[model samples]
Target: MEVLGTIISVIGLIVHIIQKVNQSSHGDTNTTYYTDTTYAVVHKFTPQEKLDNMNIDSLNICYKTAGISGFSIEKARRTLLNSYVQHDFYIDDVIIRQNCMYIKVMHAIPFNGGNKCYGASFSMNFMTVNDGVAVYGSKKINADEELVFKEIANELIKAVS
Candidate 1:
């Protein structure tokens, strides 16, 4: 399964590269370096979709905002970013992951195996960079009238209730 996963990742990287090269040949400069479709890709960003590259400390800051900790390895964190999460959703390098940040973070970083705190932070960042919105309201407000998180999580909760 690991070998299969690695193969898929390699293939996805190749496809992204080909797409990039084709776009460049047409005089398009939107060349995005993606490692694989196996990794989550950020579809949007603040101040336009172009990311200026924030430090890994930004992840820690986000974690801190959520009152969490215990993800210290800068190299590992940087590897996570560079290996996956491209462009402005990036720390650097090729993009990485599937839909779940939990699985990826849990596996990617060393010295902190199966840590929910680290995983959740990456998940949140993944969600934020991709869709970056949150919703809040009570039963008192009409569902349609309520401000939504601009993503599926908000609606899923409502549907379940």
Candidate 2:
């Protein structure tokens, strides 16, 4: 009778462990999501053959602006939309909001048959007191575009400075 009771207790313990594991495994199944609005602009410089003749580096600039408001989702969204419109960039897509505080900008520039290039991508949190924009290039960028990037950087610097 003692041996039989011990065996029954061991079986009960095993069953309890299995039940706890199963419950934990199935407890949280909801997928987490993130939201961001993407703005993109593409300019074709030359024909495939002409571009093939020249060397190119992909250039990209990403910057963040803050201080418009505290690090709130609503404020971030509003600032992002306003900035996109002010910059005159085309909005490609907007993702649903997640439980985070930040806005991001991504840029991609391709050259020379899209063979070789460099790019930049970054994000800014809403709590930031200053904003920043950057310019990245493979070899070099056009004087005009470079100037524009500088202007953007200056703007960001001013916001932060």
Candidate 3:
């Protein structure tokens, strides 16, 4: 009887430890709050066999106003288009607004035998009555390339506000 009890206790302890480890690895259960509004940002790379047979990666930012359900796609598009044009980014397309959302798509082209690359980015900005502005930006890039996504996001935020 005593041996059986010891085995059961050891098993229980092991199960408890495993559960704790799993929870910790998945992040704390505590909630996190951001003073500034949060946005869903995505960066993706796609191989373009037609254009120089190179890869094109796009970075996108989706903005939502506080208390608003859907992302302001049109506002984001306008903001991005204006900024890109002012900065002389390659303007392949204008801001697109549809289905109560704004989308901007741009691409980067490689040159100098793939030694150099250039790209454009687009964003849509939404002005909130009280909370300020929200923006979504997207840009395409070549494979194995790195760009300042965060810096651009910050700049967009500043420009619209």
Candidate 4:
């Protein structure tokens, strides 16, 4: 009876230590609060996704946002602007904070009414993480959107590196 009790206690202690290690590794989801907006950011990746550069989940896209080994916010901003202009996208707005930058891009098309316009907008955010950066954005999850994202991300990596 005494031996059985000791074995059970050891197993419990091992389980608790494993749980703690997993918790520390994954950590908590990061929350970003701006003056007018808030976002809950999490990284969800599969093993296969890590091996493929162009493949991403349907809901959203995220990248390590690394340049060489580190990241430079200023260089990222310039690359973003250059891509924005190259793609003929209008700038809705850009907000640069201490550790993050938000860029909104817009595309406008003429409506049937002479004075009215139809437009679509999307936003991309870059935030400093661990030793590099995390770049994430939302999209409609279509082929065209994915292509555009890849183009921009490639440009950013090339420029910063």
For this target, which candidate reaches the highest lDDT against the unseen true structure? 4
Model 1, span 28-139: residue lDDT tens: 6554565655856556554212222322223321211121232223333344544543211112222223322211222112222232232111222223343332222112
- Find the 10 residues in a row with the least total lDDT in model 4: 109-118
Candidate 1 to truth, TM:
0.18
Give the local distance difference test score of model 1.
0.32
Listed per candidate, the RMSD to the true structure in angstroms reads 24.3, 18.5, 19.5, 20.1
- For model 4, the stretches where C-alpha displacement exceeds 4 angstroms are 1-60, 78-92, 107-130
State the displacement of the C-alpha of residue 57, model 4, in Å, after optimal TM-score superposition: 17
Query: What lDDT does the true structure give each of the candidates?
Result: 0.32, 0.39, 0.43, 0.50
Candidate 3 weakest lDDT stretch, 10 residues:
47-56
TM-score of 2: 0.26
Winner on TM-score between 2 and 4 is 4
Q: Assess the local accuracy of residue 70 in candidate 1 as a C-alpha lDDT between 0 and 100.
A: 29
Q: Looking at candidate 1, what is the lDDT of residue 16?
A: 100
TM-score-superior candidate, 1 or 4: 4
Runs of candidate 2 with Cα error greater than 4 angstroms are: 28-85, 89-140, 147-161
State the lDDT of candidate 4 residue by residue for 33-151, as single tens digits. Answer: 35856777677554334323322232155633663455666666776665544333344444455655554444322211232132232223344345455555556456655555555
